[model samples]
Target: MSGMQDRSWWGREARATVALAYPLVLTNLAQALIPATDVVLLGWAGPKVLAAGSLGVNLYNACMIFGVGVMIAASPMMARALGQRAHNVRDVRRTVRQSLWAAVALVIPIWLLLWHSEGILLLFRQEPELAKQASHLIRPMMFGMLPLFVYQVLKSFVSALERPGWAFAAGAFAVFSNAILNYALIFGKFGLPALGLYGAGLGSTISNSVMAVGLAIVVTRHRHFRRYYLFGNFWRPDWARFAQVWRLGLPIAVTLGMEVTIFNAAVFLMGMIGEPELAAHAVAIQIASLCFMVPLGIGQATTVRVGLAYGRHDRVGVGRAGWAAFGVTMVFMVCSASLMLLAPRFLVGLFLDVHTPANAHVIDLAVAFLTVAALFQLVDGAQAVGAGMLRGIHDTAVPMLFAALGYWVIGFGTAILFAFHLGWGGIGVWVGLAAGLAAAAVLMMTRWMRREKLGLI
Candidate 1:
């Protein structure tokens, strides 16, 4: 009877996790499509446009990750509130209100950064013309940053309440809209201006605005959530609640910034090699990142699950939630890695014209990058989910230190040694990334397990 009960409980947990994660996975993929659309449309334009767009996106994301990471605090915070008492509407309302303040505060510096993208790229040693072109693309796209952050905050809000389907629907609609806009604007279709890369930027800006407004309307007007008083006070600031969010969220922002910048730094180093290398790196990284969205969604679901358990002080439930998420992510990533390893040619062909003589070199390098990417998928999935689990427990500060040490101190250092000293080119850089993710995974998982066993949460 005892064993049977344990089995039943595990099954229920797994089902609940899957229920939450499936829609979220699709939503994340849909979110990915915005950029994938840009890559695909811009790829058709030419390698120059593709490379310039990649540079712009890399620079943009390196900064954007911090803001998004900060807003992610809303998930666990709201989850805990609802989990502690399912009808704790005021707490949930407070968290949502405060998160918006943080979002607006975070975007100011990001806007300033985007305004000077040209100077930053030049300082990073990017080619002058490419830097200039990338700055042009990024400047217009900067308008979308606040909206995107707002959407993310709302995404965290709905997701924590276990209402992921609404977010998914909104994101899916945005994806479709973005694709159509990219097609129309990139090539002068549908009587729209052919602004090339700038068109792609404008498409993102418009789609982000749509998503933010759409999600906000859903949250504010939906019958189920209206009870939470989510939009009750339109003009009040709760500095205490805001500080609580920032205290937990700032470390998360720094941790994520460190991780993203590692890759951004890789892009910078690859740029030094040549334009073809940089373009191939961009395509390969984007493809790998798309695959990453699966585990990322699962990780997000785990954050909610673990957070709920933490709020209720259910230690066993917390362990089960984290490990269950870890198991699913590992299985999925293994399959994804297999696809990368076995179908490198088919995968690389998606981003480049493999048949074209001009793209031959790019395709070959991308295949190599994909192979290295395959090796890192497991650790990457582990670390991503592990981080989510820790975040659920409101344990962000130490993990921030861990990520800094792992990604920059160990990961970037290794890349420098392998790529420059050993002369292994871009492949060396990817290998270093794999190493960094492995270290972070070990550290985070170990931390979670120890805390779980000790009943520290």
Candidate 2:
């Protein structure tokens, strides 16, 4: 009877988690599509454009991840509040309001940094012409950063409510709109101006604005969410709550920033190698990132579930939620890794011409990178879900240290040794990637386990 009861309980949790995760997964993939479409469209402009755009995107994302992490503090805060048996709606509303301010405030510095893309690229010793072109691409998109943060905060808000489908729908709409805009502006379709790389940036800016404003309307006007009056006096600042967000969010931001910079560092290293290697690395990483969205969505969902459980002070529930997300992520990653291993050439061909002799070198490098990417899928998913589990309980500080150690000290250091000293080239870089993600996964999962045993949640 006990065994049967256990099985039944697992089944129920599985069903609930799947229901929450699938939409969030689709939302994340749709978000990725905005950039993937840019890559596909921009590839037509030639390798220089592709490489420049890749570098610009990586730099943009490195900054964006920190903002994302800070805004994400809202979801768990709101989720935990809701999970309590008797909680103040005013407290939840205050958190939501303060988070928006924090997000917008964070966006300013990122936008300023993007505006100086050329100087930053030169500081990294990137080629002048490529740096200038990437700078052009970043300028228009700088306008979009504020709206992007707004959209992210709203998405986090809806996800905490366990109503992630609305965010998915908004993102899907944005993807379609972005594709059309890219088509029109990139090649001057339908009497549009020929902007080339700038078109991609403009399209992103317009798409982000649409998504932010559209989601804002939906969030404020939705029947269920209307009760909270999320928009009521939203502009008013709540300093204490803002401080609380900063206290909890800064570490989270640094944690995510550390992880993103690790890959960005790999991009920079590839740049030093050559344009072909850089372009190929871009394609391989894009594919790997697209596959990663599924696990990332599951991880986000796990944060909500576990956060709710923690708010209720249900340690067993937190463990169950975390482990459930881990299991699903592992299974999905296995399937993804198998696909990459079996069809690497086919996948790489999506972004570059694999059969052309002129592109053979890039194709070959990308294939090797994808192979290493496949090898790391298990650990990548583990670290992603583990971080989410820790975030659920508001444990960001230690995980931030763990990420710094794993990604920078171990991951980047090994990449440097293997790429330059051992002469592994691009392949060695990815090998180091696998090692770093594995270390992070072990550390984070162990932290969660220790917390569980000690009833920390």
Instruction: Give me candidate 1's TM-score against the actual structure.
Output: 0.98
* lDDT tens digits by residue: candidate 2, 352-393: 876678788888999999999999999999999899999999
Find the number of clashing residue pairs for candidate 2: 0
* Candidate 2: residue 152 lDDT (0-100): 82
For every model shown, what is its TM-score relative to the native structure? 0.98, 0.98
lDDT of 1 by residue, 70-106 (tens): 9999999998887799878888888988998998888
Error of 2 at 73 (Å): 0.5
Kindly report which residue pairs in candidate 1 clash with one another.
none
Clashes (candidate 1): 0
